[model samples]
Target: MQDVIIVGGSFAGLTAAMQLGRARRKVTVFDTGLNRNRYADHAHNIFGHDGTPPGELLAAARQQVQAYPTVQLVPAKAQLVSGGPDDFRVTTTDGETVSGRRLILSYGIVDDFPAIPGFAQCWGKTVIHCPFCHGYEVAGTRWGLVYSSPMSLHGAVLYANWTDDITLFLDGHAIIDEERHKLEKRGVRLVDGKLRTISHDAGRIASVTMDDGTEIALEALYAHPRNRPSADLHEQLELDMGDTPTGTMIKAGDMQATSRPGIYVAGDLATGMHSVTFASNTGSLAAMGALQSMLV
Candidate 1:
C-alpha cells in the first residue's frame, strides 16, 4: 500500500505530494487533467510566478514532484473509492486498484454557469470570477456583476477596490431600495430584468443582452455561480460536507483533515477563498497532518 493516495493532481494534490515526497513517503496522485483554472489565461496574484498560465505552473510543479521517485502521478480519474483511513482503496475506471494508508480529496470544483448565451465560452476571459485574481489587469475597465445572491451585494461594494465603473445586473434577483441606494451611492448602475445573453468575441465581452432587448456594453462580466465538487469521491466515501458563500465544499478542520479520519481535503473543495496561494497552504497543512498521523 502507498503512503497516500491523492484523488486529484492539481495544485493542492501536487503540493501535498511534494511535501509527502520530501518526507520519503510513497504517494500516488490520480488526475483527470482538468483543473478548475485550466481555462484561465494568466494566473495572477501567485507569488514569484505572478501572471504565469495555470497549466504551466502546474506542469512545472508536477515535474518537480515526480523527481522525488516515491511519488507517481496517474493520469486517470479515480472511478471508485472504497475502504477508509489506513486501509483505503481506490480504483480507476479501467479497474486498476491501489491502496494507501491516507487519502487526500482535492478534486476541486465545477462552476454552474447560467444559461446565458456566450457566457460559458467567455469564462476565464471577458466573463470571469474573483476580481482579486483577474482584476488588476482590467482595472478601470467597464465591469458588470451578474447578481446571483445577496452576497453579490458584497461583491458590488468590494469591486470599488478595482474599478468605479460598475454595473450590477439584477438578473431577476430582487433588491430593496436601501440596497439600491447603497449601490448607487457607490456609483454602481443597477440593470433590471432577467439576462437574455452575453455577446462576446472569442471570450472577450462585447455586451450583455437583456430579456427586454436592452444591451449594456461591458469589458468584463463577473459572476459567482454556485460550485460543487467535480467528483463524487467525497460523497461515495460519506465525508461530511460544508457550505461556501458561492457553493458547497468538503468540511475541513485543523491540518485540513476531513470529517473522516485519514481523509484530508484541501484547495477549492475545502474552502471558499479560492486562490492558488490558499491551495498551496492548505495542501501543505494536509500533507503535514497526514504525515503526523502516520507516526507510530
Candidate 2:
C-alpha cells in the first residue's frame, strides 16, 4: 500500500504530493485534470507567479513534483473511496483499485453557471466572480453586479474600490429600504428587472438587457454562483460537511484534518476563500498532517 493517495491534481493536489514526496513517502495522485481556474485566462494575486496562465502554473508544478522518486501521478478520476485509516481503498473510474494508508481530498468545487446568453461565454473574462482576481485590469471601467443572494451585497461594496461606476442588477429580487439606503450611500445604482440576455462582442460584455427591454451598457459583470464539490466521493465516505457563503465544504481542523481520521481535505473543497495561493497552502498543511499521522 502507498503512504497516501491524493485525489485531484490541480493546485491543492500537486502541492500535497510535493510535501510527502520530499519526505520520501510513497504517494499516488489521481487527477481528472479539471481545475476550477481552467476557465480563467490568467491567474492574479498569486505572489511571484502573478499574471501566469492557470494551466502554465499547474504544468510547472507537475513537472517539479515528478523529480521526487516516491511521487506517482496518474491521469484518472477517483470513482469511490472506502475502508479506514491505514487500510483505505480507492477505486478509479477505470475499475482499478488502489490501497493507501491515508487519503487527501483536494478535488475543487464545480461552478453552477447561470443560464444567460453570453454569460458563460464571457466567464473568466468580462464576467467574473472575485474582484481581487480580475478587478485591477478593469479598474475605472463600467462594472455590473449580478445579484445572486444577499451575500452579494458585500461584493458590490467591495467592487467599488476598483470602480465607482457600479450598478447592481437585482434580477427580480426585491430589495428592502435598508439595503437600498446602504447601496445608495455607496453611490451604487440599483436596477430592478428580470435579466433577459447579456449582449457581448467576442466574449466581452457590451450591455445587459432586461426582460422589459431596458439595456444597460457595461464593461464587466460580477457574479457569485453556487458550487458543489467536483467529485461525489465525499458522500460515499460520509465525511462531515460545513456550509459556506458560496456552498458546502468539508469540515477540516487546523491541520487540515477532516472529522474522519486519515482523511484530509484542502482547497475550495474545504474553504470559501478560493485562491491559488490559499489552495497551495492548505495542500501543504494537509500533507504534513497525513505524514504526522503515519509516523505516529
Candidate 3:
C-alpha cells in the first residue's frame, strides 16, 4: 500500500505530494484536472507568479512533483471510496483500485452559475468572482452584482471600492429595507425583477437583460455561486463534516486530519474561504501531517 493517497491533483494535492516525497514516503495523487479556475485566463493576487495562467501554474507544479522519485501522479477521477482508518481504498473512474495507509482529500469545490443565458459563457471573463483575484483588472468599469443571497451585499460593497459604477440586481430576491437604504447611500443602483439573460461579445458581457424588457448596460457582472465539493466520497466513508457560517466542510484538525483515522482533507473541501494560495499551503500541511502520523 502507498504511504498516502492524495485525492485531487490540483494545487493542494501536488503540494502535499511534494512534502511527503521529500520525506521518502510513497505518495499517489489522483486528479481529474477540472479545477474551478481552469476557465480563468490569468490568475491574479497570487504573489511571485502574478498574472500566470492556471494551467501554467499546475504544469510547473506537476513538473516539480515529478522531480521526486517517491511520488506518483495519476490523472483520474475518484469514483468510489471505501475502507478507512489506516487501510483506506479508492477506485478511480478508469476502474483502477488504490489502497493507502493514509488518505488526503484535496478535491476542490464545484460551482454552478445562474441560468442566465450568457452568464455561464462569461465566467472567468467579464462575469467573475473574488475581488482580490480579478478586481483590479476591471477597476472603475461599469460593474453589476447578481444577488443570490443576503450575504452577496457584502461582495457588492467590496466591489464598490474598485468601481463607482456599481448596480445590484435583486434577481427576484427581496432586498431588505435597511440594506436598500445603505446601497442607495453608497450610490449603488438597485434593479429588481427576474433576470432574463446577459448579452456579450467574445466572452465579454456587455449588458444584462431583465424580464421587464429592460437592458442595463454593463461591463462586468459579479456573482456568488453555490459551491459543492467535487467528490462525494465522504458519504461512502461516513466521515464527520463540520458546520461553518457559509456551509458544511469536511471535519479536519490543525494538520488536516479527518475524524476517521488516517484520513485527511485539504483545500476548499476542508476550508471555507477558497484561495489558490490557501489550497497550496493546506495541501502541503496535510501531506506532512500524514507522513508524521505514519511514523508514529
Whole-model lDDT values for every prediction: 0.92, 0.93, 0.87
User: For residues 192-270, what per-residue lDDT tens digits would candidate 2 score against the true structure?
Assistant: 9888899998888999999999999999999888899999988999999999887899999978999899999999999
What is the TM-score (0 to 1) of candidate 1?
Answer: 0.98
Q: Of models 1 and 2, which has the larger lDDT?
A: 2
Worst 10 residues of 1 by lDDT: 237-246
Candidate 3 residues lying further than 4 Å off, grouped into runs, are 242-247
lDDT at residue 35 of model 3 (Cα atoms)? 84
Q: List the residue pairs that clash in candidate 1.
A: none
List the candidates' TM-scores in order. 0.98, 0.98, 0.96
Candidate RMSDs in Å, in order, are 0.9, 0.9, 1.5
Clashing pairs in 2: none
Tens digits of per-residue lDDT for model 1, 183-261: 9988999999988989988898999989999989999999988888999998898988878888989999899998888
Across 82-153, the per-residue lDDT of candidate 3 in tens digits comes to 886677888998999988999999888888776779888999998887788888988989999888776788
Which of the predicted structures, 1 or 3, would earn the higher lDDT when compared with the native?
1
lDDT score, candidate 3, position 247: 56
